[model samples]
Target: MDIAEINLQSRYVFRERISLMVLLCASSGRGFQVIPTSGMTLRSRSEHHLSNGDKYKDNVNALLLVATLVATVAFAAGFTVPGGFSSSPPNLGMAILANELDFCYFLLCNTLAMQCSVVAIVALIWAQLGDPELIHRAFHLALPSLFVALISMSAAFLFGVVATRRSHNNFLFNVVFNTVTAIFFHVMVLLLGPYVIPQLPGVPFL
Candidate 1:
């Protein structure tokens, strides 16, 4: 193998070993919550102030929209290119490139979007919490998002099981199906904000 391949294999091995150690440590249950120097506990419990400011909410909503769109595009496009490579023999290198890019792009974009959505939701809650006027209405609006997230997670699990069972080598289908399904669900969830959000009873829409 070339130097690059050797380096990659070694990195993979190291990561695998680290993963094993983490699993073992977690299973040990020694209650070792090593805090970071950056006041990790403070960060974990930090409270955000949600403003009813239209600009703030709009910005967050816009961010969610953009993130979801980008993620959807990346996931869909990545899946097709990578999978297309396998149909042509003697294109192993191209296939590998496509497959790797598909996995990485989908993973990165999807994760960023997911994280941003959570942050936005937390802001929404911070702003909307404690008004008896809004409990059920807020919940109803958020329920669709929750339901979609659950469905997406279920799809991911099902896909993993089915793909593993079939031993499918079609990276494009798997990646595309997984990424597109997830992004579509998330996007739908974000879009539900206006319809259900205004329904919040006690909480005034910022």
Candidate 2:
């Protein structure tokens, strides 16, 4: 081949390699569209864990869940009372149902609303950091709780697109409570201080 022809072929190969590297980096850097930053294939996998959408369909598990709720006064007042003999735990139900009129306030600040706020906070941070995959994975640590918080409250507020606090406790109260909690918990434990999450059985930090 002529010298010029050989030079042209080399340039083509170099450009092709550069293109592949760029694509790979883009995918790894952004993570996933779920957070508007997950552009890389590998990063997406890190954000979604197998536990994110697991089914809790076992009848015994369901029964235990309800029993636990009924026993909330006995259990979680201390935040760790499975034996029912522990000191009176904070009554989560009471916290949840301050007044029939104020029920939205309690649930929203405590559940779904709180969750959405958390996701938004993390999403903001993720975006701010130029969307790193590691940050996305750290955020995933709270994904399951965030999802439950939303569904539980949404179901409670059946007809209300969002609960509003005109005269009664509304959606906004909960939205702030839950969102702030999520952001704080996830960012503190997973993102900023992963080592802080306790390895104990029922601790809630993680």
Candidate 3:
């Protein structure tokens, strides 16, 4: 080939190689120059982030609903009481079972459930504000409070049932109460097992 033709071909090939290197560096993300992402990539990343945020909001909303429901139930139970209100002159407006140990326990547990549920509801409301730091803090507070509320509500239910029957020593009642207590504990252990038993080396965290 003529010298001019050879030089022209070499320049074209060199330009092609340089262009390929620039593309390779950009794709590998190790280039000296910072390459701006394409419009499609940025858009996809934004959509993915938005989807994740939406999912987080949905979860918070569901938890808020649960907390609100628990709070409402507990509050209503406090006013309704286990054995109704006394209409007598000496103990007017007091609970009929106020002196009973089971009724006292029921009231205590109901109070705890109501308080915890209120705390959870407040925290979850704050979580709805969309601040990442606040959301993290609110989640930590709300989840534990919600768990406590559930446990306390179960305890209150058990105590209320016992107080209503007025016979703790009945064989059938005893058997049913023990069975329910056992089931409650069993469910709790199962719920907590994944967090407790997955610390071993080859065990995956749930």
Candidate 4:
């Protein structure tokens, strides 16, 4: 063949190979488009297994109920002190142990317990009614509030026991009860306090 004809044939063969390559790449692209990507598949599976916030609602409600009961008892204890109320005019039927330090401590703890318990209950209720984000925030707040309420309630009970025993003139009994109460308080604070309180955001070290 002549040089011109040979050159024209080579050019035609090169064009055909280029066209075939382009067609193959286009077909491969379309094939890949037909299949779902890994990310899409993962997202779809995740949606199918999405968590429900109400899964723990029953547990939280039970805790709140118990806390409310403690609050009620604490509130009632404020009115019914260890010793009977005085009938004097100036005091106007106030508790006889009102001026005593242990009695005062009991009153302070009872008030704190009642307030914290109420706050915890409110937070839990709001968590049940609010959005997911709010629920998370409320739960964090409620846990700490409930912890404080429990500790304060326990302290109030201990103080009340001490005050009552002292008022009855039982010196040995008072010492024994106070020692046991102190041990119990220390155990509770050491074991549970650190675990519960530090989990809360912005909570200072105790």
In angstroms, give how far residue 83 of model 1 lies from its true place: 15
C-alpha local distance difference test of each model = 0.39, 0.36, 0.66, 0.63
| Cα RMSDs, all models | 20.1, 18.1, 17.2, 22.8
- Model 3 poorest 10 in a row by lDDT: 34-43
Query: Worst 10-residue stretch by lDDT in candidate 1?
Result: 37-46
The all-Cα superposition gives candidate 4 an RMSD in Å to the true structure of: 22.8
TM-score of 3: 0.67
- As for candidate 3, its clashing pairs are none
lDDT score for candidate 3 against the true structure? 0.66
- lDDT digits (tens) for residues 1-206 of candidate 3: 12222232212243443343344333445324321111101112233334443435876898899999999999999999988999987999988998999899999999999999999999988888875556656766777678778878989998898899966579997997889898986797566332122122222221
Model 4 scores a TM of 0.65
Residue 101 miss distance in model 1 (angstroms): 13
- Using alpha carbons, what is the TM-score of model 2? 0.25
Q: Give the per-residue lDDT of model 1 (tens digit) for 1-206.
A: 12222232212343443343343334445544321111101111112222222223443354345435444543554344333355466774364443443344544444444544454355346434443224223333333343343344334334334433334577987797778777876775565433222222222331
Backbone clashes (count) for model 4:
0
Clashes of each: 4, 17, 0, 0
- Sorted on TM-score, best first, the list reads 3, 4, 1, 2
